[model samples]
Target: MSPVEEVLDFLIVGAGISGIGMAVHLTRDCPGKRYAILDRRDQLGGTWDLFRYPGIRSDSDMHTLGFSFAPWKHEKSIADAPAILEYLNSITDEYGLRPNMRFGLKVVSADWDSAAARWTVVTEDKDGKQGRVLTRFLFLGAGYYDYDEPYDANFPGRKDFKGQVIHPQFWPDNLDYQGKKVVVIGSGATAVTIVPAMAKSGAGHVTMLQRTPTWMVSRPAKDRFANTLRKFLPEKVAYAITRAKNIFLQDLTFKRARSAPDKVKDFLEKQLKEHLGPQYNAADFTPPYNPWEQRLCLVPDADFFEAIKAGQASIVTDHIEKFDKTGIQLKSGQHLDADIIVTATGLKLAMAGKIAVAVDGAPVDFSQHYYYRNCMFSNVPNLISVFGYVNASWTLRVDIVGEFVTRLVKQLDAIHAQVAIPVLAKEDEPEAEDIFADFSSGYFQRSKHILPRNAPSLPWRINQEYRKDRLDMRQAPLDDGILQFRRVRETVDA
Candidate 1:
């Protein structure tokens, strides 16, 4: 039997970091607002729940990645997947957010009614059952990547390869890879992580084969300053101090890389040479592109390098001509023999799970519209979708966004406003460019076509700076002239 429809003040999508973070804010800041969260996955932690490959961890430090309101008390800033998931669960338990979450519900479509000033959402479950939800506001936290479909790259001769092929997105839970030769293709964060992880997992040989090199660097796993501060000062004070320092350092590094790519690149290579020593190949870490052009792969505590030094794993730079019966054959006439191949290539990006949208029964094409305030869409009422920073910690922007959303919701309620929509002036040009214009990552480039148009200035530009977005999203006025507020009358049958 279909479940009875229930109405809410807000309907949050996905149970990931963004969804959980936003829900906590709404509970504390907007007590009067009622909401429900729906996630397609069966678990509470979205990314952490989905990715179960060995040695999975955050690329950014937890000080910034963790929630702003609730501090991460762990000594390790670079935490493993399990620890991060535990922390998420702990927060959910603390705030009683688990019960409000509905698992195995994939959102299909959401229709906004001008007459009713509410959203009617359609969702389907794992058992092929359908459900409906009504909400005044729709918050999309489903993330950008599609969980069901990883980026499918048809590398030549994939079908004829004798060895088993695996993609990190759909890792087999029980596939025994122990004492077998493994080749992980790709040089991104995923490849770097799995190469060392698989090597430690009893793989006789683990080779990371890449066509091009990606910049990689390492940092200590634990934060001594943050740990010491926690012992003496209050939790909040210590967390704030730690978070601020990390943010400042990260921003300065990125800025310097952008401003002086040659100098930064030389320094990075020097540090890498010191770690790898003597046999260190500069060509393996050095790329044709400048630093900050793509995200620098982070190896915590030099784990990847240690694995290499210990003769557990290796990196090979070459273009793959095809997958042969034995292994991958490179264009340079070199062949890598492997018992298993792991394609950690990349992900397929989709916004809000590509849910069909309509405003008063008229289909809304995201490409035709412009993003307002980096979160809301132009002419889209009571809707906010989070697209975090590429250069800094994702949750930093997420934290600011969560606060902004609840504040906006509260202000609407204060004025008895039924619908709050952002309206871009006709004079405003839809620049048709990305908010992160200079990011040259393959994943970002691949999704550009499907991304929505964006404007270029304040309150609209998707600024990547943590310091600027911190104040802009948190301290900015809610009643900007751009947002049109109204109390639409509900239709009554005579």
Candidate 2:
């Protein structure tokens, strides 16, 4: 057994964007605080590092997605995956964050001991060696996306397929598909990206398989107004304006679309029918669900449409019956010949995987947990977690979370407090009418019971209105709770 180490003030799990963002604020805002960040992976940039599929780019506009303090200096607002990864790496390097980071260390469990006023943390290193450490606070920066394995859809006769079968999340690097026919399954961003990329790379034919059509919109990689502003004014000023504009427009459109469905349907129908042509009616491409039910797809340069127009790619609106030796057999009795199949199914989220936190020695299952301000679990002490939206940039929420924590911690310290936890009752009880987050994903579904069901208020809810979030985040009360204060002498054993 590795010897027990000195207790940490703050112990962060996951060294990805969430982890880095939180740590930066903690270190900078609170001086002389001993904090450590642990990550299972060897490198940083969690999702960005894991996914290496072709033609990957930001679905949300970059201005809203990037860190508010660190304005994105890139000419193109819609950055590719590699570029985003590089940006994350640069932040780590610039901040000298490598020293506090323990790579290849995975936390097995964390139990909160109320009597001792500390958390007992168990971690396994890369070599399966165990180590123990006590920490005052636990901040979960582990993202909502599941990293274990891809969600593989089981079609009949999948084993009989002779060609290469790849999931966009796990594409084999060595395999080349220069002159092969490719069939991409699912209609999400990954599938949309793969089709255009494969077609351009000399794939004889690329087919996009979708069970239902999603709302896809085309926008420039770099907006002219944003570009001009960035060039002339300061990056922060330009970013502020761009972020505000996108947030307002998205909220406005989504609100109008939800309230008045007919207008949205008609507008979207006319746009899709114009591009897809008369053969396939607008109803075929239009979704059965309401607009913004899921995040609308954003395409740069209208590449998906261009690929279809060029006859290199075709859309198959049929449920997959089974996979044959050469290709897939559709439910409509049509079999398309293919040398490769790519499943671009959505992600699976795991909340605080393996890190079990207990209150007063009783195991605390955070699944189906309540989210106070969408950051803290109800009645949970010295712990808070942040998850961003599917619509706007993740960094936007993460930054706000970091700022709030730092300010709250400082406020606690000022009052000679040992523990600082949120008080749900003190902060107005959330009404059923205020529950705002709308995600049908399995992760959200599994844990929604415990999460704060608010209809979307100011800081606690995801308003996506930049002006509102900015005001709330920058000017909200950091200490609204009855923070339990413990004197060191009271806990000391004789």
Candidate 3:
């Protein structure tokens, strides 16, 4: 084993919401533990910092999205990237977590040593300088999508286009599109956001061209109930109440969509009619799939519909034949001329932040293992990866997982166990199921082979139900029969 300066109790990768939340939990629950947060980016805010396209905002309400320990006092529940980043920064400063953060470091690989019961994590900085850190536990909060690459749809003859072709993931700051025709490809959240934003922000006309329509709903930017409650109650008290309310509503809506998709579809149709009125194009708005199959796009204040009604934006549903010199050629023989093309095509999902993981010199294939309680994997010792809920606010799962991790670490110390692993016997292995079977998102579907296998039941599966997961993860036995605990020989004194 290589000599290290100091061993960290927890080495958290990615200083995003998940990583920050975990650090805050460690500070409060595992106060004696030594931890450090490492992020590839120089700045903290993960998704919020990475994405800089116009109209970039939280699809989920801030009441639930914000950290449970921190109250989101913003007037708008659906906030932009700047506001979200500010909230995250405040949390970092308030918790005194800045000193423990190491930015501009990308984790390359992690190898666990059974005898030592520690992981040797390899990291590389921007200048290609390598560094190593020895940690007892490794937590991955690096998010699911690939940071270096966006999904490539590979539209034919993209090179032929003369106009500015851009992907929302990498938007250029100097590019000007005022009084110019804009075409946004894809019907996802990014596309919806860019269409309205470009339209409202001086684009002569903005057209959203999608191969297939996506489900969308509109609501007010600010939460009336939450804003009202803040006036009478304390900030934390109001946040808690609002958080609970939003979680319940989110769960209920998901359940209803799955149980009675037809009714939910009708409700969405009604909303579209109300928002777009005469401008409503059923063929362009109505999706062939059921609600919640893919994420339901949330448009704050009907801005998207208003843009279309105001003649600044339009929707074109057709397959792209190819890209031409001036614009895109559609299969319907329609040519949409554009000075700017924004490809909002979805992200490319990457598991474990594409970090090479090995256990005892053997490569670990995540697909072969079962997800143990959504936080840890089967047969993987001293590792926790936070993959949030698809249907609810991501931070809802983050808060519960944070609580569970703190509890697990405490139990390990109490039992004098140096290593804890979820061991699944060959015969006892449950039937394999897609972790995100319910979700039909392109990214989720594409990454099925790389993701860890899920089971039909609890503890072996990644439960989407936050209410159940919160209870199970928090109160469930730490020394469950599946998880094996052992004490390794002490190599160094703390």
Candidate 4:
């Protein structure tokens, strides 16, 4: 190792849920892996630290969103950002993950030299200072979202608008909209959450401006069944039961929604009517597309509708023609006056965490390869990327990925191997399938072309099923004949 370079067995990137979970798993499972985690930000919490928008909370239940090793003791299943951040911090502190993590260093590039059987990772810190780390294995556990660049919809006349415009990705502090009219644009979870939160937080009134309706489901903020189970069983046992129950029920609900869209749609709209009142416009709540085609916005305890019933917030289904000096003007000839406008538009999908990868000094293109087992990309030597499901809690898939990676690391060590690469021979390459074909969300559509397309069959299919993935990653054999193992040759000293 050079004065500036440090060598490690594993280099994990992005100190978020996945990275933290990876650290915990490595410490417990692969005891002496000699790993290091690198994060670009000063803090460890990845998305929680990045998104400071009002009413920031989990769309999934906490029982499943929380790490598998850690049972969510709190009753609030749909937790807010601060509570979530605290949970992550607790995990980091408990596992002693802080000492192994070098903060403020963002991975800029990673190059694999076949002869050395190690990756040369180049990173730039917050200070614009460059550093290097050489490691035998590289794990990309960075949160899927691109922190530096937000998805821009290129709203017409955005420059002409006079009122302060804010994006949920980088929400500013001391942003005073108290007792002032607010308009939040977008139909996703962020818009729904902000509309209700701002209303209750003393905004004069808030309107959700949407071009199309999003599927909204009202679920309990607390997990009653899980809490009851915990009362009778031990922590791990109770967590297991709740986790299994929630996963089955959520997956069953998803399958049912996919099979019977009309029934699910009617039930959801009926629920909305019950909360919003008898005269509530079901058309405003009805989405043209089926549920699960795009992820449904989960409104905990119908709080969003409660805000509307209390005359604090409203929903406007109209296309914005342009942003005038005061507010947004609709193409439907209606104008919405606003003191503040929030573009909860969405984020750009970045599969590789924006880090450049090269092999033998040649830049690697992710689009050219297929994702093997939804974790490892084809021909990506000694690398595993953790990108989670769109329909379920991110931690569900992340936890599974962590366990699988640990198994791989141990297997490599057992075989005296320095590198384990996914090699796709001619027969192994299957037909490409557009995995994001059904997802019509703006974010998915924005960068759909850049995402790695998977094969239609096993080992390459992009799985959204949590139980299936758990079985596949946890119980499956590490030697699937697809992974090629290599070891560095010992050179005799002259």
Which numbered prediction scores highest in TM-score against the true structure? 3
Model 4: lDDT to the true structure: 0.86
Output the better candidate (2/4) by TM-score.
4
Model 4: number of backbone collisions: 0
Worst 10 residues of 2 by lDDT: 485-494
What would you estimate as the lDDT of candidate 1? Answer: 0.86
Error of 4 at 268 (Å): 1.2
Top-lDDT candidate index: 3
What would the per-residue lDDT of candidate 3 be over residues 295-362, giving only the tens digit for each residue?
99999999999999999999999999999999999999999998999989899989899999999999
| Clashing pairs counted in every model | 0, 14, 0, 0
Q: TM-scores of the models, in the given order?
A: 0.97, 0.90, 0.98, 0.97
Q: Relative to the true structure, how large is the alpha-carbon lDDT of every model?
A: 0.86, 0.75, 0.92, 0.86
Model 4 is weakest, by summed lDDT over 10 consecutive residues, at 485-494
Off by over 4 Å in 3: 1-5
| CA RMSD (A), model 4 | 2.0
RMSD of each: 1.9, 3.2, 1.2, 2.0
Model 2, range 201-257, lDDT digits (tens) per residue?
A: 788889998888877777788878888998789878988888778778776777787
